[model samples]
Target chain A: MLELHQISKHYQPGGQLIEALKPISLTIKAGEYLAITGTSGSGKSTLMNILGLLDLPSRGDYLLDGVAISSMNDQQLSQIRSEKIGFVFQSFHLLNHKTALENVMLPQTFGTVPLSDIRQRATHLLQQVGLAERIQHKPAELSGGQRQRVAIARALMNQPKVLLADEPTGNLDSQTTLEVMALLEALNQQGQTLILVTHEPEIARRARRCLVLRDGEVVSDHLQRCTDPTQF
Target chain B: MTAQAKFYYLHNHLRSCLNELRSHALRSMLTTLGIVIAVAGVISIVAITEGMNHSLVKNFSQLGTETMMVRQNIFKAMNNDVLQPMTEREWFALQNLQTGISAVAAFSRVELPGTGVSGVRISYAGRSQIGRLLATSANLPQMTGRYPIDGRYFADSDSDARRRVCLVSEELAATLNLQLGANKPLLQIGNFQLQVIGIMPGGNRDILGTSADVYLPLGFAMQLNPKDIALEFGFRSLDESNTEHIKRQVNQLLRQIQGTRPNETANFVIENATELKQFQTDTLGTIRTVLLLVIAISLIVGCIGIMNVMLASVSERTREIGLLRAIGASQSYIQSLVLTEAAILTTVGALAGILLGLGIATIIAAGIPQIEQVILPPAAVVLTVCCAILVGIACGALPARKAALLSPITALNLE
Candidate 1:
């Protein structure tokens, strides 16, 4: 349910032109899991930022659910981000001062949901991610795996249609990484669209389809089926 | 937004800040130091002014509500320090005037040494108490707005017939160990027996402090002390209006009677209670101005301190503001949040200062006997609160603007 038509993004530093994303075109249907794999400086992160509506394209048309978002103001873009897209960062960007439950409830603040219901839903999501006992613990008190779980629960708080995880398990150990992958796979199997950016081949193999990007352009788009999606 | 929602938001934000403040209680107290000092200074000055105003009103009221004084003045051509005396003819002319003249009386002094005139004896209580006897007309009670409480005063016939009747003050009676009442026997002063009519209550004993006074008939005083050339005349007017006119006319008539030129300076001066009241008002005004200046300086210092603290707080909360914005908080929300914190701090400080100031004033007023009571003027209280609110808004402006202008991405990048 996302489309990008000839999107081009550039940056200038010290009067030198630097291309972050070259002209590119892509489309993803509803309820499909996709992976954008690339090395450092390959523009995958920049594409993810543009896809999430966190940044605007220098020149392009971004149609999200069939509405052109390039003409939307910052406020309208933010509203769409809050209502339609959930983001999971590699660093797990949970507010250091807030408990796991509060971090998960952060996105719900923009909606009309009652605080008590938000708390209950956040508690339930944390329990689903095997963090029921650690829901009240702040990020500083949690392990690497537990912090990522809190981020994942937070990304699902508003029940967004698309879950965008930018290297969600990049900082976790292999076993914790497998658990995070399994959690994401289970959500995707339930018909929620998932898009992840990663450089790890084994991690990329877990997605239903993998798209390789290099030098600010997509080099390949291939479909993959793992022997066991729950294992690394 | 609904009021309840707004209240919930504000309450949570304030509670969070308060918890932080409680964690650093000593620092918070230090931050509030400027506010406390300013409030205390304001209170003290206001209290002093209130106390002075109270005392002034009391003294004036004691002088009587509808009392005015009239006296003769000599015309001065170049020098203003000339003194002049009024003649008997001029005094009679004033007494006959139909304008605001209430009662007219002339005064002369006499000294009597040793022994009692009637039943009351004479004794010296202090140096000034001895050889100070006032000889005035029988209408002295009406002119001075004072009357005997225990014994009779001299009658008009006593002055007309030049009788040697006299009245003694409570201090003189007490010194002689005599009881003074309406039926009490006449007091003896210098071999003259004067009947005791009444006793006058001494209101401010320290100011009109001593009570050792004696009153006698003016004509009898003239007869007893013929060579005493220093004679002072007093005129009591009906009210405040005709006092100036009566004074001018009396001065002119006195100049004509004494055969002095209009341009020539008089040898006597005219004085009144009005001059004393004016002096009191000027003194009060000067004191109020000085106090207001001090309060203003303190308030400025307090405002500066508030601004400094708010700026520091804004800088510290930059990342938190960014996080809120990233989570969908509007820019106005961030601005309002910072402004709310500022308003809360300043309002609390100001309220604390007002209470502190009033407390100090009450304590000082309680300790001083002359003050009677200390009252805060409504206008002063209103002004103080308004100044405090304005200071809060002014101090919050820069920090609030900075918070509102911060970009969400840049703010999130703040470490």
Candidate 2:
């Protein structure tokens, strides 16, 4: 579960104030598939960053699993991010120097997890994503779809409760996008909450709930029917 | 972290960096060149200072343990030109003077015919040999700490009988090819037929590389060679204390014997062991300071080299650092990694420098005729190594800090 109250993020560009995220409020329950969609410069990425705890809100309180994280230190924020949330990027930012398996094991190094256990979990996640044969390949050696799969495996390394995908299919072909979307759907079915950020209507269509933003404020919230809420 | 865990972390960091360095072997070797030159500079300077110190101590020890030279005036030249020699009256006055006066000896120079070298033409036959020949009472040996290496020195009986027996230096005996048991009497010079009684050990050679000459009994020397009058005087003391006081008293006594005016400058000089030691220490100190300055310049150049290479390494590993930081490595961890690389490089270089320095020192010391042994003090080696390590750490600080401060997001984006 996550809640944002009166969230706002402002920046000074060329000495003029620009509000990246206007005052807004939102909430999502556990095991839900949500998508935040907007056009370029519409603050969807800013909202996503705030949700991921990668950036601080200018004026807001963020409650994640009932703990207020607005005033926490950087180290504490990092700890919560490591333990409670996992991130996937559009670029599939897998470390170029590491193999797929090592990239998956990266997040585990930040937590108290045993190295052997982390390795085992990463291997299983890679297998679940149909990348078992490609675990030893570096990001440059893998296809876009395969690299996204490795990124997904890395996000799950600490067994975080929420998976945040920021334009996960932005760099992939249509077929690879469908494959990555299917993998996200399968992960949602396994009871992990998924927050997908995208600009494409087709990508947002896959989510059970869609929140649309125009400028920096939420414009619409819609819920759709899927086979099962638990399956998403 | 626990010490063991910290050690493990350091070990892993060093191992990874070393592996990377090995992959870029030429770059790594170039990086280490600076450290090598810096450490070598330190080692060479220290070795030279040690050599000079050794020579000073050896020469000082050879010049009698507690001896003090008392002449007419503090400012006078060693070779007296104006002052009269110490006569019997002045010696009697010195015998009664307090303040630890031990024994007095009168020194002069002379020349003689070459003994047992038949048909061999000698150069400068009319000129004085200018050998330091001492004329003293039987107590001269006790005062000077000089003992015969063969045969014997003059006895009290010899002094009383005014016998003309002579003691030569080992070098002088070797020069004249005079064997210890040879039946020939020592060559006659003036009225005395000086029998060769003994040979003294070779000491600090003069500028011409010649050892000191023969000794003769005071009574016999004064009686046989009255006109060979270029005299230099010495006084051995019972203890080093009161040497200054005795020197003053002896100066006053000399002035009284010479019957000079109160402010008239005397011809002879008075030199104390403390002054000699101070002179030696100051000379060595100056040499050491100059050497250290040169070493410092080399170390600075070495540090500059280290900085240049480290900056290049930082650029090469920019993406690697970003990856680590993204994966939760703290800035401190990145800094530690770079610093560890520097320490390892310098430590290895220091070890090499010490061995090389000692090897060179050994060779130089072995080849020199004066040095009997070459000793590499452990302190010198330790100091040099520490200096090198400190240089590494100092040179690494800025680069490590720069690496640590790199933004993970930007670094991750760098190709």
lDDT of 2 by residue, B1-415 (tens): 6776565555555555676566677877788887776676667656755765676676567566466655444335444445455565666677677668665665544333333211112212242232445566666556555678888878878977988787877766666666667673454444445787888777323211112467777677667556653455556777676676777877787777778788877655566655756765797799878877887887788889888899888987887777556445667767877887888788888888777766776676544434434556789888877877887889889999999888665675575
Instruction: Check candidate 2 and list the clashing pairs.
Output: none
Best by DockQ: 1
DockQ, cand. 1: 0.12
Candidate 1 regions exceeding 4 Å error are: A108-114, A223-232, B1-286, B367-370, B377-390
Worst 10 residues of 2 chain A by lDDT: A223-232
Q: Which ten residues in a row have the lowest lDDT in candidate 2 chain B?
A: B116-125
lDDT of each: 0.71, 0.72
DockQ of 2: 0.10
Give lDDT tens digits, candidate 1, residues B1-415.
Answer: 6877776565555654564455456655766678767877786678766776776666556565345444443244236564544445555776787777666776654554441322223433232233246667677666556678765677889888987666666665565555654455555455555555555443212111112266667677667656652455555667666667767876776667777777766656555555656765787789878887987887788878877887887787787666566555566656766676666666667678878888888787654434546777878777776766677778888888898777765665565
Docking level of model 2: incorrect
Identify the runs in model 2 with alpha carbons over 4 angstroms from their true place.
A98-102, A108-144, A225-232, B1-29, B51-63, B66-281, B304-323, B331-407, B413-415
Candidate 2: what is its chain A TM-score?
A: 0.94
